[model samples]
Target: MKSAILQEADAEQFAEAGFAVLPGLYAPAELAALLRTVEQAPVSGPNFRRSQEVFAIRDMVGAVPALWPLLDTAALRQLLGQLFPTGCQLVKAIYFDKPAGSNWLVAWHQDLMINVSQRTDQPGFGPWTSKPEGVSVQPPVAVLENVVTLRLHLDDCDATNGALKVVPGSHRRGVVPAAAIAELTPEATVCAVPAGGVMLMKPLLLHASNRSTGNRPRRVMHLEFASVELPAGLAWREGKRLMM
Candidate 1:
């Protein structure tokens, strides 16, 4: 089995490319349990969205409380510990799934906004917006650089099944202007991951996905972790912290 610990090479890859994919992070039964929990989660939350093309929960672990216990598994903790030796707070979690024949497509963009509990007078933090999830604001560039995202795949992902496409080292340029993102790259690497694998990436990574051309579902749990605390009175919306 592939080790959950981030190796030296993996760390370098993340430092240079801003993303890395680790396959076979979960066992078959573990993946099954996650899918079952999500399937049974009540669809009665403001963050829940269901349509012909996609199923998503913005405040995922909050909406499905049962998911908290499931996520406390030892394997995940090991991986988190390697990244954040002291500890890391789970700032956000999202459940997203693209069903077979679903025409769901996402454009290349950086995850610059963060969902916070309330608006506070914090210098360098601005461009606030309200959404069903919570109050999302674009924090300082330093904050965005420290945000790490782990995408847990519940199904196989590939070029034909809407796998993510990311521009290598695009994050090194810092927050690229919206108009400059399109010019960031015409070259990207397809990050294919098997079921139960995890894709680790920085929040500033330029990533996108194409509509599925294959007949397979792509279900993923997107979890964000922050190693630093917010300034001012601002708090993470979820405030769900996990450690080994």
Candidate 2:
């Protein structure tokens, strides 16, 4: 765990840029151990989305228990408390690996959907989607606005290896149109983080990734946090309340 809180300047950067990167928070040994654990972690049955180009595991708490301690660390708790004073909990976890040969590319978009345990008719939530990935719904814009995402890099990521590209301050625009994304993405900035570093971002931040051209693996543990509660009996599918 890091010994100090995130710098106030970086916090301000996150507020304005909708994203921030903390470099070398973990040691090489720690990253090696984590990588070994992730390589051995059990994945969701055959439904696991594995391909020549990439592999993804959702609901990662059940699939890779070794990574759960990340949210429990005192440094992480302090960091979350600093960013979200009202308190936040882990609502989702996903592991994505862009392998050398896979040619997967994600287009510009905002992460507006959330994982829920069951499909319920809730006002302000609409157009529920269910696929092999799981059940998701577009929650209220307020929910997305309050959400924060952390991506932990297990390997060095750079533009050649599909590092994330984000449009600065786009989260402030709320939900945007597809045409707006097409127009704004040209101004996106690539965010490259070293192995053992973490990238913090807002859910509404417009972002995307290009295909890996350098043939290097980019493995990341993506975690989402939210403090809001669901209405009715609907619950977060992978939610785990952190002990702060």
Candidate 3:
């Protein structure tokens, strides 16, 4: 399905609110196809997280090559171009499924870290860590400032279904201290999205989610894009640069 075009109002809203919802970005058929693909793919692995109520496919793009064509379609390329006019590349992608009975809850915080190919002693890049998916590092705020994350909702997401709660304009507070996160008093917004809608948010935005209390599952495909190239010797973990 064709992705929705990024409007000027969306750009303005993202700059001011740190996020913007692109309603009905994907057609119903597109969502159905994606769900089918997920069901058929051989994704069970160490990167895949499974529980009685929750299941997640981490590093989905890396795990399922067949999904690349759908993800890199022309419509999506155009949408990403609007956000990254200078040109951008895919950094990471993951699929999250929170079932009705899953007791999954994420606390309020910022996505301050990023995925890198390897760990190195780089100035301003610290708090390094490792994950089953890839190496993680806390890069400078400038790097994250240029990063945009698009979350495609496979199910209707609302407050009852684990929709993201974000502190609007928090992206402007570069590198907010963990202790100071609560100190920054700003009105939060619930990012409710439709089944085929998309939520565009900055990597530095302060956001979190609650456990689903609804009866249906809340599935989301999270894709992150960044235009900035890492310093020499440092590379993106996925490294699937878009040829835009």
Model 1 C-alpha lDDT per residue in residues 12-106, reported as the tens digit of each score: 99999999888877888889999999999877769899999999988888888888788777878888888888998899999999998888799
Off by over 4 Å in 2: 1-4, 43-47
Tens-digit per-residue lDDT, 153-206, candidate 2: 998999999999999999999998987788888789999999988899999999
Top candidate, metric lDDT = 1
- Candidate order by decreasing lDDT: 1, 3, 2
Q: lDDT per prediction?
A: 0.89, 0.85, 0.86
* Poorest lDDT segment (10 consecutive residues) of candidate 3: 66-75
- Deviation of model 1 at 112, angstroms: 0.5
What C-alpha RMSD separates each model from the true structure? 1.7, 2.0, 2.1
Off by over 4 Å in 3: 1-4
lDDT of 2: 0.85
Tell me the TM-score of each prediction against the true structure.
0.96, 0.93, 0.94
